[model samples]
Every structure is written in structure tokens, then in C-alpha cells.
Target: MGILVFDDMKMLDVSGPAEVFSEAGRFGAEYRLTIVSVSGEPVRTSIGLRVPADAAAESAPPFDTVLVPGGDLLPGTPIDPDLTAAARRLAERAGRIASICTGAFILAAAGLLEEKRATTHWQHTTLLARSYPSLRVEPDAIYVKDGTTYTSAGVTAGIDLALALVEEDHGPDLTRDVARSLVVYMQRAGGQSQFSASLQGPAPRTPVLRLIQDMVQADPAADHSLDRLAERVRVSPRHLTRMFRSELDTTPMKYVELIRFDMAKALLDAGHSATEAATLSGFPSYESLRRTFARHLGVSPTRYRHRFTTTRPAVDATRPALPDVPGNR
Candidate 1:
């Protein structure tokens, strides 16, 4: 596999999959990894570490796969023409192509993802879709495979995409071993949303907003209507709504719902029944919880719990009965 690297690129975007493939090599897999740059010069990473390139893009050999890792490409900043051209050339000759995070922008610049279903970091998905109107951008996928071209979401999702590639090349057993060695799950489904409810809440900007959030979290079942919140904060309902929108980028009720959903997920992960979780988390009914789970998490509460619950090993029942040696009983 050939990894295309550039200045200011995210180091993990290149290293994560590189490490996976490197580990796979230890297990008897044959993966010849090469890091290439536009001119064979050492490139500085986003974190200020310098990485030496193995070859210039112009001289890099054709490979089974070409992987492009993302960088900090700010809006309206033009992609390097030489880099895009090299990607086009390499992609045209390679067996398959993939991009990590905002590297989709580079692929799109090279016309590799034209009319293709692709995804990028959730934070950049809208910009990508807007910039490349012809591309079918999947905002929620951890990674998307369209034909031989693959696009992955932000940072760590690249590892999941690379694992999928390894699984395709090797098999389930080897892939599982690789994942085990790396201490990450074998794979997260591509359709899983990139954001979890716990990670979605924006930080409260002011003491009033913080206090209101604390109160809502303290009692999810309380009457957290806009008027009630406004009364607690001594503000008009309209001002409260504006403040919430400004601070949280969401309405008051939506923030409350997010908190409730997060609490419900925690309850479910702790092995609570769905109906009980719904009741404790302030959902009006079990159906409401189900709908919220489906809407935001792309799975039912039961499925989410089953997928995410941490299991402990069961006790052995037939271990010689401990010899029944108690204190003179």
C-alpha cells in the first residue's frame, strides 16, 4: 500500500492505518508500506513532527492501494495542484483508493469522487457536500465504500476503515487478531453516527446557562419547559430561547431531550431495562425512547445496549466446591 503524505497532515491519519498494517505484517501478512510526498521532501505534521517521505509522487510505483490522509485545509484554501495531480495519477493506476477524514477534499479535487458516495469528518461534511455538489456525502458514516473508492470520517474512523480493508484482504480471524492486538473493536458499522449524545452537548458559556444545565441534568423528569427555565433564570422566555440557541446551538427542549437521551443510554449500558430507562430518563414512553434512539443513534435502545454493554465473566460453579473449609461451622 502507498500512503500519500503532505505537510500539515494529521499524523494519526497516516500512522493509525500504517500501524495496523505494520502489525498485520508481524502476523505473516505481506504489506509493503510506502510513504510518498509531492517532491520526496520531509513533511511536517499538524502536530509539528517531521516525517520523511520514501519517494516523490512522480516516482512512486503503482500499488495495490493508495491511501490519502487528511490535513488542515481551511475553507477557500486551494488544494495544491501538484498533490491533487499526483493523487489523480496514483488513483488511476492503483487497484483501489481511499481517503481519511478531510482527505476526501483532496480526492474530490482530483475528480476521483465525482458523483461518488463519500464522507468526511462530521464537522466538515456539510462543507464537503456544498463544495462538491456532485458527490453524495454521507454525513453519519464512520466510513463509506463506493466501488473501489473509500472515504472515512474523522480521525479515528480511519482506523476502522483500514481494519475493514484488512478484513477484506485477510479474513475474520486475522482481522480479529489485529483488532485485539490494537485493543480497538474489530469494527464500528459504517452507518453508526460519528457523534454520541454525551459528546454532542456544547459547553455552557455562562454561569446562568451552566446552572440551568446542571438543574436539567440533576432532575431530567422535572418540568424543564422554556417558561420554567426562564423563571428559574429570571429571564423572559424569548431571551432564554435566544441564549440557548446562542450558547448550545439548539433549542431548550432539544437540549433537554439530548440530556435525557444520554441519561437513558447510560442506564441501558448499565443493564437497566428499556422501559425503566425510559421512565428514569424522562421519556414520555418506551416508544419515545425507541424513536429517539433510532433518530440519533441509528439503533434501538436494546440493540445499543447489547452492542455497548460491558460484560463480566461468569463465576465457575464446579471448582471443587472450595473444600467447604469455613471457621469451625
Candidate 2:
């Protein structure tokens, strides 16, 4: 794995994945890690930490996988042309290419993400879509894999993406071990929206709207229909719908659905059965919950639980034990 680093890059964007791959090596996985930059010098991170580079981009050996990490690439901020060119060259020669967060911008600039489904930090998704219209920018995905190229959202999503790559290259057993070592969920229960739901919608403007939002969140099972909500707020149903559209930019029913979905997901993540979660989250029935999950998440509750659950199978006594690592014992 070759990770390209540069000035102002997010430190976790590089170190998080590096630690996962490094841990996999301890578990008997074969991974060769190298950090490179346009120049061979150490690069300062966005948080002011300096990390030494292994080699200059031009001098680096060929890699099976190349990752470009995100940086402070805000709007009107200039990207280094030399770095972009080097990334393009490395991507062309690598078996697979991936980007973390705003690194997708570099890949897009390199022409590597053209006509591909990709993602970046939610705050920057619009810019990426606007800048590279040919690229299908998925704002809410944790990560997207299109053929040999992969792109992920935000900084910590890099770890999730790296874990997924490890799972593909190794297997679930080893991947689970790595996740256990990291103390992170084997996989996140949902997409980036789970972490950024507040940012997803416009803030409630009026006190009535705010109160209704809090009520729905506190009790998703309550009557949250337009008529019921209007009654609670002492407004006409038409006026309530207009308020939701103007302030939330969504219908009242849509807001209720989002709240119910979040509540259901929380219950499922807590190890609740689908039927139990559905009934508790006001889905009417398990079938209703399943349909809602499939329509919005494109995955069944069972599948989501299987992927995201931290539970793992008992270790096989016959298999060789993992070697002890310093500080772990």
C-alpha cells in the first residue's frame, strides 16, 4: 500500500488506515506500507504534526494499491499541480486507487474519477459534483467502490474503507480481529448521514417546529402525521405543511420517516431483533420496517445487522493463536 501525503493533509486520513494495515500485518497478513510525497521531505499535517515521507513520488516502487488522503482543500484553495500529476501517474500504474475525503478532488483533477461513482466529505460534496459533473458524487456514502477506484467520505471513514479493503483481501475473520483491535465497530450501522443527520436538514426555524422535532425524536411512535402535528401546534394542516417545506425543506411526513428510521437503526444497533425494533420504532410491522429499510438503505435489516454487528464467532481452538503484541498483553 502506497499512501501519498502532502502539506495540510488530515493526519488521521493517513494514520488511521496505516494503523489498520499495520495491525493486519501483526495478524500474519502480508502488507507493505510506504508513505510518499511530491518531494522526499516531511510534510506538515493540518493539525501541525510533521510526518516523514518514505520517498519522492517519482522514486517510489510500483504499488498494488495507492491511496490519496484528504487535505484542507476548501473552495478557491489551490491544489499543487505537481502533486496532482504524480497522483495521476501512480493511479495509472497501480492495480487499484482510492481517495479519502477531499482527496477525491485530487483524483478528480487527475482525471482518475471521471464518469465514476465517488464521494467526499459531505460539506464538499456539492463542490465535487459541481466541479466534476461527469463523476457521480454520492454525498452520503461511507465509501464507494467503482471497479478499481474507491472514494470515501470524510476523515474517519478512511478507517472504515481500509477495513473493507482488508476484508476483501484477507477475510472476515481477520477483518473482525482488526476491528476488535481498533475498538471500532466492525462496520458502521449506516451511512455518513448517521453521523451527520443534524447537518442533513435545515434547522427548525420556529419554536413550534423545534418542539415538534424534539417530540418526534423522543417518541417516534407518537402520532406524527400532518394532521396530528398541526393539531399539536395549533396550526391548520396546510399551514403546517407549508412551514415544514419552508423551514425544513421537506414534508412533515418525510421528517417523521427520517426520525423513525433513525430510531429503528438505533434499536437494531443495540442488538434488537427486526420485529422488536420495528414495533418499538412505530413501523407498524416488521414487513413495513423491512420495506422502509430496503427503499432508503438498499439493504435489509438482517443484512445491515450482519454487516455492522460487533458480535463475532468464537475463536477456533485448533487454529494457531495470534502472536502477542507489546502493550496488548
Candidate 3:
């Protein structure tokens, strides 16, 4: 595989996938990894680290796959003509193509993804779709495969995409080992929004907003209708709605649902069954919990538990138990 590198590109966008392939190679896969920059010169990465190129992109041999990883600056900035040209040139010679995060911008600018279904970081999916009107962008996807072209969400989702690629190349057995070696799940249960700020935003600024949020969280199963929330905070329903929109950027009932959703996820992560999780987290029924999971997470509650929770019984019974994570062990 050939990785196309450029200045200011995110370091992990290159390294994350590279490590997956590298680990697979260590386990007897036949991947020959190479990194090529536009001019074979060392380029600065997002964190001020310099990455040395193996060859110039224009002169590099065609590989089985070419990867275009994202950069923080690529989302809103102009696509560099030289970099885009190099990517276009490299992609033309490769058998298959993929992009990680906002690297889709470069691919789109190269006219490769004109009509392809693609995605980028959750924060920039709207901009990507609007800027490139021809591209069919799936904003909620962790990664999308439209024919041979693959695009993934921001940052760590690149690893997920890489694992998928490895699975396609080899099979589940080898790919699962690679994922285990890296200490990441082979696939995440949901879309990127579960890791985004829409549901997990900053603390409320005002006293009333804070107080109202506290009450909703304190009893997610309770009737947190606009009228009830307003009564608790001694405000009119309309005023409360406006306050929530201004501060939390969501409605009162939506906030209540999000709180319940969070609790349900926690319960599932702690080895509870979906049915038990729903009951403990205040959902009226397992069906309600499943609907909320499908809406926000793009996966069923049972699927989410198996993928994310180490304590839960995994569907892939061949695998041993893994640790739950805030960080690597």
C-alpha cells in the first residue's frame, strides 16, 4: 500500500492505518507499505513532526491501494493545487482508493469523488456536502464504501476503515487479531455523533439552565416535558425552550432523551442486557431504547453493547475478553 503524504497532514491519519497494515504484515500479510510526498521531501505534520518520504508521488509505482489521510487545515482551507494534483496522479495509478477524515476534500477537489458517496469528520460533513454538491455525503457514517472508493470519519475512524480494508483483504480471523493487538474494537457500534459534541457539549452558562439540566439528569425517566421542566425552573414553557436552544442548542424533551440514552449506554457497557439497560435507564420500553440508539448511534442496543462493552458477552465467541477503555492498558 502507498500512503500519500502532504504538509500539515494529521499524524494519526497516516500512522493509524499504517500501524494496522504493519501489524497485519507482521502476522504474515503481504503488505509493502510506502510513504510518498509530492516531491520526496520531508514534510511537516500537524504536530510539528517531520515525516520522511520514501519516494516522490509522481515517480512512485502503482500499489494495491492508495490512502489519502486528513489534515486539520483541510476542512475550511483552499485545496493546495500541487497536493491535489499529486493525489490525483497517485490515485490514478493505484488499484483502489480511500480517504481518511477531511482527506475527502482533496479527493473531491481532484474530481475523483464527484458522484461517489463519501463522508468526512462529523464537524465538517455539512460543509463537504455543500461545497461539493455532486458528492453524496453520509454525515452519520463511521466509514462508507461506495464501490472501491472508501471514506471515513475523523481521526480514529481511520483505524476502523483500515480494519475493514484488512478484513476485505484477508478475513475476519486475521483482522480480528490485528484489532486485538492494537487494543481497539474491530468495528465501532455507531456513527461519529456518539463521539461528537451535539449530545456532549459544555456546561450550561446560567444558573437556571444548569438547574434545569440537573433535574432532567437526576430523573431521566420522569416526565420532563417542556411544561414540567418550565415549572421546575419557574419559567414559561416558551422561555425555557428558547433558553435550552440558546444554551444547549436542543429542546427540553430532546435533552431528557439524550440523558436517558447516555444512561442506557452506561448500563449496556456495564454488562447489562439491552432489555435491562432500557428498564434501568428510564426508557419506557426496550423498543424506545432501541429507537433512540438507532437514531443517534446508528446501531441497535445489543450491537452497541457487544462492540463497546468489555463486560458484555461478545458476538464473536472466538475472541477473548478485552478491557474497557479510557486509555490503553
Candidate 4:
């Protein structure tokens, strides 16, 4: 498979999945992992690092499958037309195509995602849908495989998608072994938002914002109000609102809602009852939790768990065993 890393890329978007593929090769699977870029030279990463490419786009060998990685940059503008055209061409000939994170933006821009179901980082779902009206965006999944195209949400979720690919290409047994060797769980339940906590609420700047962050993290289930939070942090409500907008690029209420949903999903995945999870995560009631779940994930909480927590048939069931290649293992 060929993994393409574009300029201003997120490093983990490719590396995490590449690690899974490398380990799969170690377990006797045949893989040809190549990194391609528009120019043959190394592309700088978002985290201030560089990764060298195996070949330039013009001279790169054909690939059986293609993977595109995304970054923190905006997806709809300043993209290389040449790169988009190349991706379109790659999708035509490749057996399968996939994207990690906002790389779905590249595919959608390439016209590859039209009429196909895909997922990107949940934060960008509305933007992606608005930008590409033809593409159907599903936000509830960690990774989505629709026909020959695949897309995943967020950054590290790419690793989970890659393991699923290995499971499809080889079998569950080998997939399990690779996961065991990697020391990371092969599958994550629900979506990327589940694992994320408020950590630092809406990007702290002032000491007051820092205090508010601490309060949110300490008691996520509390009935936090703007006035109460402002009093706790010794700031006026108007001043607090301005600071939140300037630092977090979001409102205080919205940030609290994100934190509540994030923590609630985690608790639900940990086997907590929906009512308990709702209460613990600061939602007013279970009905409120259900409404938010439907709005953000497009699924009822029960349906989301049922779809993700349940297992599916192995992909290798209809396939023959792979032929042994000399020196492959």
C-alpha cells in the first residue's frame, strides 16, 4: 500500500497506521509501504518535524491501496490542485482508498467522496458536509468503510482503522497478534470524542480561565453556570465571556457542553448506566444526554453502542490463504 503525506501534515496520522502495517509485515503478511509526496523531498510536519518520502508523485510506482493523512490546517482552501488531481487518479486505479482525520477533506475535494459515506474529525463534520454536499458524512463511527473507500475520525483513531484493514486483508488471529505486540488496544468503542476530556477548558489564557478549567475538570458533573464560574474565578461575567472567546475560539457554554458529552460517552463505554453517566457528566437529565447524542453522533446512545460494541464477520472468510513470498516474513 502507498501512504501519501501532504504538506503541513499531522505526523501521527500516517505513522500510527504505518506502525500497524509494519508489524503486520513482521507477522508474514506481504506489504509494500511507500510514502509519496508532490515533491520527492521531505515534507515538514505540523509538530515541527520532517518525514522523507520514498518517491515524488510523478515517478511513484502504482499502489494497491492509498492512504491520505490530514493536519490542523483548513481543508477547503490553499490545497495543491496537482495533488488533488493525483489523488483522483490514484483512486481510479487503486483497489481501495482511505483517509485518516481531515484527509477526508482531500478526498472530498478530489471528488472521490461524492455519494460515499465518510467520516473525518467530528469538529469538521459540518464544514465538510457544507463544502461537499454530495458526500454523506457519518460522525458516529471511529472509522467508516463504505464500499471501496474508507475514512476515519480524528488522529489516533487512524491506528484503529489500520488494524481493521489488516484484519480484513489477513484474518482476526493475525490482527489480534499485531495488536498485542503493539501494546495498544486494536479497537476503540464509539468515537474519538469519547476518550477526550475537558483537560484544559477551551484553551486557557488568564489565571481566571485556568481556575475555571480546574473547576470543570474537578467536578465535571457540577451545574456550572457562567455567573457561578465567573464568581469562582473572581472575574466579571462579561470579562469571562470575552476571555473565553479570545482564547478558546468558543463560548463558555459550548465548551461546557463539549466536555459534558465527552465525559458522558466515556462513562457509558465504561459500563455505567445511561442515567448515571448523564448525571456524572453534568447533563441535566438522561433525556438531555440522549438529545445531545442524537444531535452530535446522529444515533441514539443505545444504537451507537450496539453498532460499535458488536462484532462483525471476518473479512477473510471468503478469501483464499495468501501465497508465501520469499523473504517476506
Candidate 5:
């Protein structure tokens, strides 16, 4: 395994995957980890730690897997040309290449993601898509696998991607042991949506779509079928769908379901039973709700409730807000 490092990079992007591979080695996996930079110098990580490099990228041996980690400065700022050149060289000598978090920016900059389906940190997925029209960007995936290139969501998703790589190299049995040792799920419950603003996505750019969205949010249990919604909005069903797809990137029915799903989560958080929440959220029955939960979250409603329901204090009014960090978020 070869890890490419640079200044201002998210510390965990490199360390998290390295830790997973290190733990897998304890179970008799022979994985050699090598860290490199362009000029064979130590790189300063996001948290002010200087990580020593094992060798320079120009002469490092070919790797079975090459990891490109993201930095805070990689997204908004123009990429350093030298760094892109080095990444291209390293990728040329690797069997497979994986980009962690905003590292997808680097890969996309090098033309590696052209014509490939990929993803990046959720907050930057739009910019990625806009910048590279040839790549299919999946904003909701935890990680995406496209042939020999892989791209993942933000910081901790790197660990998830590394776990998947371990499973591919070794087997499910060894991967399971590594996951147990690290105290993380062998498989995460959901995509990037679960950790982000699940209740809030992009607001509609036009009033027509906004009105439709408001109608769904106002009464999730209303007749939100495409035809009915189109009737309510005084447009044809096909036109309504075009309006939704143009602005919201989803069909009308899926948007209605998303609204109901949010209501179901709120009801469950208020201690309502799953069956009641299901009914109240417009689902026909508990089984329907369970299936929806599994599709969106990879877990049952009861299990999702249990996993996130530990008692806690209310939001602290005087607490400081989080500072804005681009790729690190």
C-alpha cells in the first residue's frame, strides 16, 4: 500500500486507512505501508503534525493499492501542478487508485476520473460535478467503486473505504476481525445523507418547485401522487415531473416520500412506537416503513432508534459554533 501525503491534508484521511491496514496485519496480513511526498520531505497534516515520508513519489516502487488523501486547501484553491504531476506518476505505477474525501479533487484534476463514476466529500460534490462534467458524481454514496478507481465521501468514510479494501484483499472473515478490533461497524448503516442535513437539502431555485416542496412538507400524508400534485399545481403530471427533475433532481413521488421519512424520524425521536410512526408518516403499515428504513439506512426503524437514542442534554445555547473547514468537514 502506498499513501501520498501533502501539507494541509486531513490527518485522518491518511492515518485512518493506515490504522485499518495496520490492524489487519496483526491478523497475519502482509501489507507494506509506504508514505511519500513529491520532494521526499515530511508533510504537515491538518492538525499540525509533521508526518515523515518514507520516500519520494518519483522513485517509489509500484504499489498494489495507492491512496490519495485530501487536504483542506485542495478544493477551492487551484491544485499545485507539481502535486498533480506526482499523483499522475504514482497512479501510473499502481494496480488500483483510491481517493479519500476531497482527494477526489486531485484525481479529477489529473484526468483519472474522466468518464468514470466517482464521488467526493458531500459538501463538495456539486463543485466536483460542475467542474468535471464527464464524471458521474454520486452525492449520497458512502464510497464509490469505478473499475480501478475509487472515491469516498468525507473524512471518516476513508476508514469505511479501507475496510472494504481489506475485505477485497483478504476475506470477510479477516475483515470482520479487523472491524471488531477497531470497534466500528463492518458495514455502515447509510450513505452520506444520514450524517449530513437529512432534513434539509438544497432549496428550490424557482417558486414552482418551492411550492411543490412546501406542499409535501406541509402535509406529508396528503395525496402527493404525481397526478394529484400536478392537479393541485395546475400543471400536467409530466410537466410537474420535469419541473422537479430540473430543480430538485428527483421525481415528485420520491420527494414526498423523503418528507414523510423525515416526519417518521422526528416521531421516532419523540418516543413514538415504530408502528405508530409509520402510520403517522403516511406509510401503509409497519412493514412498509421497515422496508423504507432498510432502503435508506440499511437498518430497521427499531434498530436505528436504539443506536441513536441515548439520552443527552438539549443543544447548548452558549456553545460556540463550529468553524468552517472545507475538505476537513
Candidate 6:
């Protein structure tokens, strides 16, 4: 396998799988690894560490696999066309082409993701889809296997995807060995979004609280004052507050904010403009939207859109709307 590292490339993108393949030595000498870059010179990783490439891309031997990683690049970003073209040429002979995080951007720009079901860092899914309309981007997937291409979600998910590759190429026993040695989880069953959402405070329970969740998701833009919501559900606002704390573990207003944030994320993922997403999500202004986004998600709406939104496509028409409880990720 050949890992083609690039400028400002996420170090783990190269090292994660390299270590996985290297660790295969513990089980048996099963795979070969070569790290290459655009030029023969050493390059710096995102963390300011220097990594030396075994050879230049032009001189590297053909390999069965190619791996790429993501980094912070501005939208409509211009890249060295020649370097990208070289990577694309190398990919032609690769049995599998994979990317971790925004590294999918490089693959997509090379037209490798065309008409493929792929995913990237949640924040970049929309922009990747928008930039490459033919690519089918699944926001809720931890990793996507589209024919010969395997794309994974943000940061640590790369390790999971790499382990999956090890299992596919060798065996489950070898993968387990690598996992045990690494001292990390064997696998993350769901998408990265679930892990990210788990960082949100606890969810709500109880019939009234559940009803509130349903109503908020149904139409977050609805004029959902706590008093009106309580009255319609046959309870006083004070009782609603008590129930919310008792069951959901948060106040009614805080729960509303969470619901609104979820809706805004949905809208943003669906390709709505930030201004439109803010208004539809019940935030009084874009500033409010940005503040809540930073407070809850650690990213701005624009940045989130840059990472996740390209074109707003309708959700699955057959799935029922969110019920009276928060939907599982």
C-alpha cells in the first residue's frame, strides 16, 4: 500500500493506517507501506511535525491502495492542478481509494467521487456535495463504501475505517490484534454525528416532554412560547418546567434551544443558506444563530455549511417525521 501524503495534510490520515499496517508485523508480515509526497522533500504535518516521504509521487511504485487526509482549506480553494492530477493518475491503478475527513475534498475535486455514495467530516459533507453534484453524500454515515472507494468521517473515525480495511484484507483476528495493541475502541458502530450529539446534554423523557420534542422538530419555527406549549399540552408552564427537569434533565427553555439547534443543523445540512437556516430554526438573528452554534457545536454556521452543505435535498420521503421523542442518531 502507498499512502500519498500532501501539504497541510492531517498527519493521522497517513499515520493511522501506516501504524495499522505496521502493526500487522505483530501478527505476521502481511503488507508493505510506502509514504510519498508531491515532492521528494520532507513536508510538515498539521501539528508542525516533520514527516519524510520515501519517494516523490512521480517516482513511487504502483500500489494497490491510496489514502488521503483532510485539512483546513477555504471554499473554492485552488490547488496545484498538476499535483492533484498526479494523485488522480495514481488512483487509476489503486484497488481502493480512501479518504479521512476533508481529504475527501481532494478526491472529489479529482472527480473520483462522481456518482459515488461517500461521506466526509460532517461539517464538510454539504460543501463536498455542492462542489461535486454527481457525488451522493450521506451525512449520517460514519464511513461510506462506494464501490472501490471508502471514505470516512472526521479525525478519529479514520482509525476505525483503517481497522475495517485490515479486517477486509487480512482477517478479523488480525484487526483485533491491532485494536488491542492500540488501546482504542475496536469499532464505532454509528456515524461520527452520534458521538458529536452525545456531547449535548441529556435528552428529555415523559409524555409532555416528549410531545414538546415532537412539536419542536415538527416545526421549530412555530411560535412555541413555553406558556402556549404547556397550555396546549394541558399543563401550566411551571409544571412543564418541573417535568422537563424531572424527565429530560433540563429546563424547558434550554430544551427548546437544543431542539432549535437540531432543526437548524438539519436545515443547514439540507443546503439552506445560513440566513435562511437561522430564521427557520427560530433564532432571532444570524448573530443568535452563530452564538448558539459556537456554544453548542463549537463551529459557526458558515463554517458548518462549508463543511456540510452543498445543495439542499429533501429528506427520505417515506420515513415518518420525528416522533414524540428525540430521534436516535
**Highest lDDT model number:** 1
Residue 79, model 3: lDDT of 86
CA RMSD for every model?
A: 11.9, 7.3, 7.1, 7.5, 11.7, 14.4
User: Which candidate order results from sorting by TM-score in descending order?
Assistant: 2, 3, 1, 5, 4, 6
lDDT of 5 by residue, 1-329 (tens): 88999999999999999999999999877788999899889999999999999999898898878999998788878999888888899999887899999999999999889988788887899999999899999887778777678888889988878887776677668777888899876644224352523345687877877788788777777778888888988999999889878877888887777778878877876768898999888887899889888777655788656523221112224544322111100
Task: Give the lDDT of residue 143 in candidate 4.
Answer: 78
Q: 179-264 in candidate 6: lDDT tens per residue?
A: 77987555543233534342255555466777888888788878788888988799998988888777767777777787788778
What TM-scores do the predictions have? Answer: 0.76, 0.85, 0.82, 0.65, 0.67, 0.62
Candidate with maximal TM-score: 2
lDDT of 6 at 327: 15
Identify the runs in model 6 with alpha carbons over 4 angstroms from their true place: 74-76, 190-194, 198-329
TM-score of 3: 0.82
Query: Clashes in candidate 2: how many?
Result: 0
Residue 307's C-alpha lDDT in candidate 1?
Answer: 35
Clashing pairs in 2: none
Better of 4 and 6 by lDDT: 4
| Global lDDT scores for all candidate models | 0.82, 0.80, 0.81, 0.76, 0.79, 0.73
What lDDT, from 0 to 1, does candidate 3 have?
Answer: 0.81
- Model 4 global lDDT (CA atoms, 0 to 1): 0.76
Candidate 4 C-alpha RMSD relative to the actual structure: 7.5
Sort all candidates by lDDT, best to worst: 1, 3, 2, 5, 4, 6
Model 1 Cα lDDT, one tens digit per residue, 1-24: 899999899999999989988888
Q: Regarding lDDT, does 2 or 5 come out ahead?
A: 2
RMSD of 3: 7.1
In candidate 5, which residue ranges exceed 4 Å CA deviation? 189-284, 294-329
